[model samples]
Target chain A: MENIALLMHGFAIAFSLENMAAAIFGAVAGLIIGAMPGLGGITGVSLLLPLTFGMNPTTAIIALAGLYYSTMYGGAFSAILLNIPGDSPAIVTSLDGYKLTQKGLPGKALNASTVSSFIGGTIGIIILTISGPLLAEAGLAFGAPELALLVLFALTSIGWLLGDDIPAGLLATAIGLMFATIGVDPALGQTRFSFGQINLLSGVSFIPLVVGFFGFSQVIDMIISGEDGAVATKVRIRDCVPTGKEIKMMLPVSIREGIIGTFVGVMPGAGATTSAFLSYIIEKRINKHRDEIGTGSMIGVAAPESSNNAAAAGAFAPLLTLGIPGGATTAVLLGGLMMWGLQPGPLLFTEQPDFVWSLIASMYIGNVICLILAFICIPILVRAISVSKKVLVPIIIAVCVIASYANSNAMFDVVLMLICGILGYLMKLADVPTTPMLLTFVLAPMLEQYVRQSFDMTRGNPSIFFRGGICWFFIVLILLVSFSPLIKNFYLKMKDKKAN
Target chain B: MGYVLPGLSVLMGLYWAVKAFGYRLWVLNGPGGGLFPLIAGILAIIFGVVMIMRRYRTKKKSDFSVKSIFPVVSVIGIIIASYIIGLIPSLGVFIIAWMVFYEKEPWLKSTAVGIGTALVFYLVFDLWLAVPLPMGLFELI
Candidate 1:
């Protein structure tokens, strides 16, 4: 009953002319950014962070979160038409989506992708509304040791979960942590590695780093490849409609993936990219018509696109409730919110119910806007892609450098951006999962603070790491997962010997 | 793949494990602020070294393709030059020219497209967003 009243109140606030316009604008912008390869949800949201400077936190968060899900719809366009996945989460989509294009089913594949994204995204938003408060309460009782352990668990899971390249992933994560500490020390009121530079106080700006890594790097790709990139064909999309058979086939799978993805996304560290990859794998295993999965399978495009966007919505639960950002872009949002003097936590739910509730309402509104925009404005976005890369790459790089410099008007940021861009490209070449790097960058400072604070509380006792039984459990969980690679390797060796 | 193992081992040997003393010496009386990052850093390095020496050495390279690397390098250079040439209008002009010519769009169409995009940028960032654009040689109204 209260949920309904609160929801109605949220609708009242969300439906206001100003907020609605912002949501609409955000949807359109997000759609475009999502379609551009290398520019993911994180980069798109980070660019809009500054634009939210003057708005209310509720409205700002609503607009930004709206963009996050809108991308799932937008990412498929290029993947289908050009065979270039716009977002990493859409990589699964490219398999069957591009194949569909080759087989002259591009329009049908696009419709399945977008409509399923809307369905999945809506499910994620509702789960966040119902369960976020409870999760926040559960986290409130966890102390510093538990928090530290949780962050450690997150690092281990995200990195080692890649299965074969666990060590390289962890190393990339460590490098990201190193980058996180490059500026002034957050505590102790002193600078460590500033190297006597003035602009190192506030550390690196998020926008420039993301823009360079994802946005500029991709623009560079377009130019280097000499226009052989996606959208190379003169594909005239047919009736962008899924047949009833297609719709019937997708409804159950999308729902299952949506539920599973939202559940994972609400957890502190799991997010859209992981969810999309995992869901696509699961979809392939369970698909009734499995043979078509990687070759013009409509389910392939629908499954991941739906779940990935749903995961985007589910990620906000942690950000809103426990003051913990589940992913990179949410961390950027957290930083922006703090800069505006709004501390994220349980109090955000109670004192700023409108910020919580209206933001939820806006997700519902945003999903609809995304559906409409994707259905109507794809041809418009295609025009942007048609403009060619010779001019586009340099213009984007120039804009990215300027954007970095303008974050705080620091020249140092521009330099950091170029270096990070190179580093990002190198990481890509080395197959070091950028997810670990991104996750570590967001959580390292907080993890550091939690450890230091816990040690201080216990007055330098190393054994304090396992103070309570709950803390002990968390510590063991992290340790076990971190060392699982060794166990796996040993098992494989034994199996080889037995076979011989 | 060769770079992977070396990178990991080098990071392990050079960056964090050696910093223990400097960190302890620098802030003897303060909190053990460097402990977690130090430990994480060391663990990361050790794991990396282990992986490179053992796992990396055993792996084979079947997916290697270097046919199109030079063009990629050139494009990256063009991007860096975009920044070195002062961003905004000049870089925009350069990007447009490169795309049209190097990417092989016709000269007349490229010129029109370049001028159109330049005008759009002028309107969007300068007029609308209120960001100041570098006028440079075009400063004379």
Candidate 2:
């Protein structure tokens, strides 16, 4: 009953004229950006961050968060139409989606993707609404020792998850933690890492790092990879709206994926990449028409698309409850939360229940607004595909430069972006996934502070780590990931011998 | 590209390691300031070495081509030129001009498009939103 009152308050916050308009704008923009290959909700939100400096924080947050779901829907259109995914989640849609397009079921694939995204996204929101505070309550009971272990566990798990190559990811994370310490030490007044540079004293800004790493570097890579105008491909499935008969066929699978995806999304370390893979696997193993799994079936597009969005929304669970970021986009969203002057943690529910409730309420309205605008703009956005990439790249670069400069009007940021962009481009050339860098960028500060704080509390006694089984659990997890290379190599060799 | 790129990352890593050492290790009762970055620097260098070795061990194909330099260099050159001009609008003007010339659009059409785009952006970002933009030669506005 109390939840009902809070939800009503949430509706009041979301239904406002200004908030509604922003949500609609975000929904449209999210899909547009998401449709572009190699860009996703993260890129869209990052691109729009500069524009949010002036608006009310709640308004800005509402709009940006809306982009996450809208992009999920928009990305499906691209996958089905162009056979290219805007992000990890949309990859599966491309398999059956493009095949469906060749068979002229582009309309069904696109429609299925949108409806499934809507279903998955909404269910994920419901879970967030009800379960967020419940978890936050449990998280508050956790002491400093628990948090210290959690951060380490996350870093170690992510390190091992990137492959048997734990060093590179850990090194990247260490750099991030070091970078986090650059500013005036909160504990002590002494500037530790500044090395006499004025800008260093303030610590590196999150804006430049995010923009350079994701945005500017993206442009550079796009240029390098021969911008094929791949994004401009339009979805022209004959029926822009789904037929009643088609809806009936796709309803069960879409709903099931939405449920499965929401649960997958909530779990830590289970990102969209794995979620989509599992959804495809599940669809094949359980579907009534299993043989139709890969050959342009509507279920193929529905399952993964549903799961990915659910996961994206579910990715919010850990971050909101425990203040732990679950993915790259969520990490940037953390930056947004900070920019809004609100921290995501256990105390948020106690201290600012209104803010918490209102944000959740906004998602409901935001998702609906996204659906309406995306439905309307499908034709115009698809027509944009005909625009030549040779013409588009220059225009995009100009906008990016202006946007980066506008964020703070700082020349240093522009220079910083160029350097990072070059390095980002180089990293891409080297085959080191940029995903780890983003995760590192998120975890760096928390890792440093928690380790220091825990160490101090323990008075140099490493036993503080073992006081709770929590730390041991994470340590075990990391060990498993660390030894994964040997296991993976053995498995491969066994398969090779069998083939011979 | 292989040796030079990884070699450069290693060099940067070494530089950071030296800088990290300049900060005292473990402030009293606290983790030393260099704790995170020094570790990071060393790891980055190690990873760079691994990448360099793997590049050779696998004899992997290079997706990069030499012609890629033209787009990068030209875009960078334009950015530098804009800084030299010390005018945001002039930079905007030059961007459209470069596009026209590089793409071989007619000068008249290019100038017209440049002027129109500059005005729209100036009005949208500056006049309406009132964002402070560099005025350069047209400081009167």
| Leading candidate by DockQ | 2
Off by over 4 Å in 1: A5-26, A29-117, A128-135, A139-143, A159-171, A186-189, A211-362, A379-411, A424-439, A461-480, A483-500, B1-20, B25-33, B36-86, B127-141
lDDT tens digits, residues B4-80, model 2? 55667677678768877666567766666666767767876887777778788988765676645654565466566
Count of backbone clashes for each model? 6, 3
Q: What DockQ would you assign to candidate 2?
A: 0.37
Query: Against the unseen true structure, what C-alpha lDDT does each candidate score?
Result: 0.67, 0.66
Provide DockQ values for all models, in the order shown: 0.29, 0.37
lDDT of 2 at A108: 63
Model 1 chain A is weakest, by summed lDDT over 10 consecutive residues, at A228-237
Q: For candidate 1, lDDT tens digit of each residue in B51-78?
A: 5565457774422235224334543453
Candidate 1 C-alpha lDDT tens digits along A1-500: 68668877999999999899889988987887776544567777887889898988777887887777787788777666555556656656776786775565666777888888988898888877777777545434566676677666655666433436766777767666765665555345455445577776655555556545554444444544455444333445454567788899999888988887776566555567657766766676567876677668888888888888788887787788778887777888788779778888878878788877898899999999998888886545444444444545544555555555544544566676666665665555556555466556756766766666676676666577777887888778777766766888999999999999
CA lDDT of B71 in candidate 1? Answer: 34
Model 2 chain A poorest ten-residue lDDT run: A135-144
For model 2, residues A1-500, the per-residue Cα lDDT tens digits are 77768889878887889888888788877877676544567777877887988888778877888887788888777567654455656656776886676565555666778787777778778877777656434434445565566555555555432444554455455445545667765444567666677766777665556545555666666666765544444555355577787678678877787777766565554556556656766786578876787777888888888788877777776777677766677788888888878888878766767766777888888777766776666555445544555555555555545555555666565565666666666666766655466555555565666667777887766677677666677677667656756788999999999999
